[model samples]
Target: MTDANTTLPKTNSSPWTSRPFHRQYLMRQANNLFDFFEAPSLNPKGGFFELDDEGKALSAANSTRQVHGTTRMVHSFAIGSLIGRPGSGEMVDHGMDYIWNKHRDAKHGGYVWGLDDNGVTDGTKQAYGHAFVMLAASSAKLVGHPLADKMLADVTEVIERRFWDEKVGAVREEFANDWSQITTYRGQNSNMHLTEALMAAYEATGEKAYLTKAERIAELIIAKHAVPLGHRVAEHFDENWVLDKQYLGSEMFRPSGVTPGHALEWARLLMQLWILGDKRLSWMTDAARNLFRQAIELGWDTQHGGFFYTLDWDNKPIMREKLWWPVAEAIGAAAFLSAYDRDDYFQIWYRKLWDHAENHVIDHARGGWLSELTEDLKPTSRLFTGKPDIYHALQACLIPLYPATGSLTAAIIEAEHTVKQHH
Candidate 1:
């Protein structure tokens, strides 16, 4: 029996709160890291390097080895920008020097974008790749990492000089090894994602330039990409902020279905901007709420109870599938909304998210999550049956402190367990 009151929890520790499932994931990530450092084998007996057909990262390979994107995203949480303690061992990258790698292409500016078939940094770099670097570096700064400033500065210059669409005042898709911008229609996913990274960067450094660019692009996400009445965002855009109706590629997984995570990330960014006192984008918060409810109505699985990976705008079932990232973003929304304590209408959504994460996705047996489950809450991707470093774990780490969840003690206990595994 839990009470649904708005009283904030009095926590002495950091803002990151956790639960059983989060603790399990944290432990799995930790054990997996230990396994990577301690275990030595050819394949390493884990699925950390599973790549989608298009070379996008899929999941962790083994206990110690995490995929390139997974490693970057997990660092976002551990670097302590949003919801965790800072300056910890979970950050020291033995997998690959994500921050300060002299071995990779220095001309590329961003870290090596991919690992070779034999486990070395491949030289190609993508805009999305640099975005993750900014996010992780900003988070590292929040945690008192001495190198945070350098990480933030290096990546910021790379994006500003290379990815920036000077005509439209935004970023493009990919860049050459020498930081030359790829002349193609940009991806709204990475653009939004880069804005998100910029938001964190602004929070870390209080640099007016970062915040200013982030605000302009965030407005573009609304005016340029966001469809007003339809409650959907354009997944791709031209340099002038026009919607490219011929949406192709996994720039967003748009060809698959409506991605809930992307929308939520925008919502949180809007709120963060609001906190920064950029009230010009305040209307976007309501728009963000509309998208959030759109996601809840369309993505939430009624019988099985979890979010579908993709769905239609009118609450219609397109794929009716589930993915790890959307659930993670949904967790982000619930936590951010919990801080608002506005009308009591939002509590139900948070409860549904908590209920689903606890019951279906978390694997208490293996000390992590199953990674991917179907709309009916059955397993889908065995690639991450063990704990994989992912954005989901970072998002989950914040759920307990939001005050919407009933037990602070439980969340704290879970955070404690998670940090123990990581530290």
Candidate 2:
């Protein structure tokens, strides 16, 4: 964080306002490039739900591709949330297919945790898994996709079919094939994420059902998830919102104030709804602030510009390595702030984030972002950053110098060197 002021560039321009229109659209073309796969999900996991011809699995491997998958989902969803507008019918058709193909539990209609390397369904309905649907559906509507409204309805079916819990009005964290609550592993992280997703949907549609879901999740956060002793959130919980150690396994819950990654994501999603007069989104914004501030106080590296991979409950640096996702989430949160906040405090973090990441993650010499980096903004591992996943062209920019206006596809055609998994 030492370079916050020194490395950052002074811009007199407005935060919301971008560059020249033609150039802006050119960069945006890169954003649109991922619609082929990176942006849309005909089914949930990878949205494509099978291995590509090269034998790359359609779904992200949590461990096999740990470095990229860690935060790729957020970036993917952020991009997809904006481009994948679908209808209720499309949402259901697509969701059910994925549930059946990649995510579905064999015994029930609910989705599986995610797919495996063989592209097989080892079914479990993780809370994070379902949140993907909610977030995508909400963001799709914002971009006027023909299927957006129906996609919202399709996700509603998922909630009614599997996510909704009548007694709690909040989603239980996980479930068996039939959507029965996983009693042994009770909790609220999923609920919190679900809240974040539902908030996005609520803002996009103004649907009372979504708001009801958000409010209930908020109640669950305040009641059970929020640390009574501190401002952070417990990563796991019991059915009654009691602390549950067993569910956390050998990996003791780090008990940080709140994960900056999740907190910033919540802030962005909620802010989308805020301008429309939904005050509930404020919880997301406020919670993000608390968690981010806590990170600064407890987890930030005074010598390094980015955040640590993990921080302990009392703000101790349990894992001090810098990971890529936090930077991306921070960028997103700051982008929201630049657009909405009057003070512009977020730019401090946002600027540091870019400077740090570009130094490490962005491989200017080789191309694309690097897979990982060290505490000193150097590579810690091999250049296994990521497979060349696609994205909407609107967000993709080869560089600020050359954007994808009329030639994103053409750039791919001309690109002789590409980073990909060798089958």
Candidate 3:
């Protein structure tokens, strides 16, 4: 229940930000996650298995692999490899091989949405999935995976040729397998993630085009849309790039009204974009602040110490259930905002958010972070079943360990180089 604008005395005593012990704690948490997901996530049939609550594969033979889950495993394990974790390289290799051999549409030229042992369960090509594909490729490239270059090139082509709508400076939402039946529904979630992938891709390849596209998406989404709405990120839009306030597609992905988690996510991404663009886009920093403010102001459940999943146009909490990713993203955003402005407010929130995670979200007895929780912060699986994701929690632990200026991969590389030089 801390006010976003509550001015407090500046203090440099945040243990999470300054202490060596807390740094080690962060690394320990990260490595625990890597150890948790690295084994069971690998599916011998093809892509990753959806893990159950106890960190076991839910199904091996008949499990369906969503593009986002598959790609996230690749991306997370690549980070593991970069940090010199054992068996991480093989995890990356397995994901790369599966992506190329199984997920990639050999006939259709775009990646499929879902696959199983019988093959192609859902053939719709989504910008959201493709964004994660780009992310996996870029992370794999950083780890020196042999297939990274080809995969990156292919996904880039698919995104440009099919998804990228130059008229609006953002990618289109979804399409059918044969590149037909293009959906007229436009969304900010996919585009936001694509901005992340493009930045990571730019870091991997030194491609200005990728960075430029990322900048365009940031401007289109955050500056053009969210800024006008008091920094509340509108989730759904129409083909004409107009806001579709009444559009409610899915409970998991496309939900009604505003998503505070995405606002928290954009706050972090906008700061990274600003830093990567040499801080030329000054408006990005301001936008990041406002978005974070709005999210905290409107989304935070003051009584429960967690963020609400969704909010209405009136800034009322719609889905009051708490989820893990938003708290994770809030940690990341607060870390960057604190680093940039040296404000005690951000620093205080950074610590408080992590405290919340340690208390409620993270399954200390188990392995991965719990996905869903009730308003009072008890574990629940109403929306997400089992512990199927490591991306958000991993980033929450790792992003703070480095400076806020670049992609986590780049920051990892730079840190390694500095370590070797000093030695």
Scored by TM-score, the top model is: 3
Q: Mind giving the per-residue lDDT tens digits that candidate 1 earns over 1-423? A: 122343334451222334555556544453433333222212232213433322223443422232345345435334332333443344333322433653235654566565534443445566776777787676666555666677778878878876786667678776556655555666667777777677767756668887778777776776555646365666666666666655555522334335666676666666656656455556766766766766565556666766665555454665555666667677666666656645443555565565676687655444345567766777775333333444455455444343332122223444566778998
- Tens digits of per-residue lDDT, candidate 3, 163-246, equal 998988999999989888677999999999999999999999999999999999999998999999999998898899999999
TM-score of model 1 vs. true structure: 0.73
Residue runs of model 1 more than 4 Å from their true location after superposition: 1-87, 93-98, 102-104, 117-122, 179-183, 227-229, 251-257, 278-280, 312-315, 382-388, 399-423
Cα shift from native, residue 359, model 3 (Å): 0.5
lDDT of 2 by residue, 302-410 (tens): 7766676555565666555565555555655565555555554665665555566556655444333443467776665432234233321122233222211111122
How many residue pairs collide in each prediction? 11, 35, 0
Q: List the residue pairs that clash in candidate 3.
A: none
Please tell me which model should have the higher lDDT, number 1 or number 3.
3
Ranking by TM-score: 3, 1, 2
TM-score result, candidate 3 = 0.97
Candidate structures ordered by lDDT, highest first: 3, 1, 2
Please state the error at residue 38 of candidate 2 in Å: 5.6
Least accurate 10 contiguous residues by lDDT in model 3: 1-10
lDDT of each: 0.55, 0.49, 0.91
Compute the lDDT of residue 193 as modeled in candidate 2: 63
